[model samples]
Target: MSSETKSPTPSAGLKSNLPSTTTFITGHNAEGKAIVLDSRPATWKSFENGVMGFNQIYTNPFPPDLNGDADLHFHDDKIASGNLGLAVKNGTVCRMVDFGPGYVCMMHRTQSLDFGIVVEGKIDLVLDDGSSTHMKRGDIAVQRATMHSWRNPSTTDWARMLFVLQDARPLFVDGVRFGEDYGRGTEGLPRSGNDD
Candidate 1:
């Protein structure tokens, strides 16, 4: 990653008001005993004019190969390359997102099954049909290739969400395939599965 894009410690980000996130990665030692491979605050990337930020926790190709800790190497490569997009083809990505106060994300969709959990504050999940649902801490939203947007209703506090996105077959609704849609919110970022 370029120095400009490299993330500083969690306390140095645009969303400093939000609490930092610590990630724990486990692996097996040479003796085959489980060990703590890594435990530290996650790296974050602030975007959308600093109104939104993403902390990429981990990623691995589907049917991950853990032997020799190859998956860990893969994740390190992704970070070093600084091309971890919204989704990985035939893989899974665990990320944490911070929404600035009163921020509303653009409507978009990805070809993945996402499990989004509200970790702090409240948010509204708005669907393409104009329907929405209010969610608070501890609430989880199971998104199956749906066109949606997220809105943080708070005007003074930031909201945090942890999402696990797993690649899925392209959604076919009425014979129409809905591929990855970055929409307006994601401009510089590549589309899903295009990190390379």
Candidate 2:
């Protein structure tokens, strides 16, 4: 059982109260035997000047080719290269995000379907139309391709959420195509190739 561990380090000017998240990858060994491949903590990348941290847990292209462990090698390469982006153009990505106390993310839109699940603390999901919904632990927000943002309402504790994003068909409303809008959170992250 091969393992790769990365200890979580708090970013400068921010201290997160959330614990580290560990991920386990399973695969088949030689002779067609199932086995645990890798188990380790997902590496976190600080963003918004330490107001937020993101960890890419796993990603794979749509219609994944699992034969011969090709997908496993692909994921390994992505981790080694450290080029995992916010969303995959023709794939799916699972990510975990930590929000600092009272941090409000910029209003942005992605051309993908997202399942955002609140894992810790409380958060407010704000929409472009000025409507907000308070989500507590175990609440899930199925975010379609829309303009939205996340706000951590607690001023003394951090919040965490897990998001599963899948590439979606181009979204058009009133003949206006809305692509990816990273807003103020574009630093150190690559576009998901859905931009218009």
Candidate 3:
């Protein structure tokens, strides 16, 4: 057959379904109303498509005096170091993360230890003792198993955070219980806005 004599039929259809992907419902609004699933919640498999999620679980029990709000968010798709799920190796683990604008996250515990570092943007860490810390870029705090909450102060900006969580333990330390109290160890330590 001549080179130009024949041609294959051209396929015509939607070539990409990425941007138009379906949203999966997983939560609700602050008013206890049905929440539209804006995006998929972060899971171990989230790293597969260069898109991870870290959002407030609106389905869980709402914190006292508060409604459903996702002040903290995390988007981590790249594996910075080690193999996938490497965190389970040491029996103790740490995770560093980056949050985009409209991002917020936690660094304290109601049931476990939480730690965080703010490399950019502003955030507020609220403690169970009615005390709170307002942190800006380059600030960090570690929670040794204390009840706490995380909030984002900016309306248009996203805060990037580096979180380090330790494996759960029966006790905060020998003879020291972190079950229902924390943040009192900061009497001598500089707090947020300390410029440290």
Candidate 4:
């Protein structure tokens, strides 16, 4: 038996992994009846020669209903995840990311805490402190509003990760608040696309 994991290839015109089948479940009426609100294949957005794939799962509005056992919210599909915009105040965003071989994202920061899990292949989590760690399938990463990047060094493999981001206080340094900096410290890297 071979120990190599299979690398993903794009499906026809799709420049990313096979679309994810997402089913959104929610509660209905005052009785909290469970129901499937929507179920569809996730639409992928490609970046940097199809080296990266982005598919948003959902976005919760501000002040998530704490009083209700079942929360009814709307997701705005028009906004792209690459826009570097945070979710609504006290809100959260869920997404899936795919990294192709030789893929490396710019070192950037977001104003939200992120929980990520690797679903396939392996990747390197590069941090702003000149450090990195290799992550493989089933590994979970809890990023607390830190400056970081994703690197896929393999030349014949791809990596996929799912992330949940929640709004958080900006990183404060010496009494200065440093919020999301998408292109910060990304010199010498591809500027257009491949950012999240």
Cα lDDT, model 1, residue 14: 62
Local accuracy of candidate 1 as per-residue lDDT tens digits, 49-164 = 77888888889998999887799889889878877778888899999999999999989888899999999999999999999899999999999989999999999999999999
Residue ranges of candidate 1 with Cα displaced over 4 Å: 1-13, 194-196
Better of 3 and 4 by lDDT: 4
Inter-residue clash pairs, candidate 1: none
Tell me the number of clashing residue pairs for each predicted model.
Answer: 0, 0, 7, 0
Top model number, TM-score:
1
Residue 23 error, candidate 4, Å:
2.9
**Model 3 segments beyond 4 Å from truth?**
1-52, 55-90, 96-113, 172-196
Candidate 3 lDDT, tens digit per residue, 89-191? Answer: 1123344343334433433343334567876667788776878799887888877656676676776664545565444444546776654322332233222
Arranged by TM-score, best first = 1, 2, 4, 3
Residues 1-196 of candidate 2: C-alpha lDDT, one tens digit per residue: 4755456544444457687778877788777787777776657777767888887787888878888777777767776786766778788888899999999998998999999999999999999999999999999999998899999999899999999999999988999988888887477677787554
lDDT of 1 at 130: 95
- Pairs of residues at least 3 apart in sequence or in different chains that clash in candidate 2: none
Q: Cα miss at 121, model 2 (Å)?
A: 0.7
lDDT of each: 0.83, 0.83, 0.41, 0.66
Worst lDDT window (10 residues) for model 3?
56-65
Q: Return the TM-score for each candidate structure.
A: 0.90, 0.89, 0.40, 0.74
lDDT of candidate 3 at residue 138, scale 0 to 100? 82
Per residue, candidate 4 scores C-alpha lDDT tens digits across 1-196 of 1123234333334454434555354445446765544454566656666678667676665556534432333454324333434344466778788888878987887777889899888989999999999999999889887888999877888888999888876577889776766664433323212122
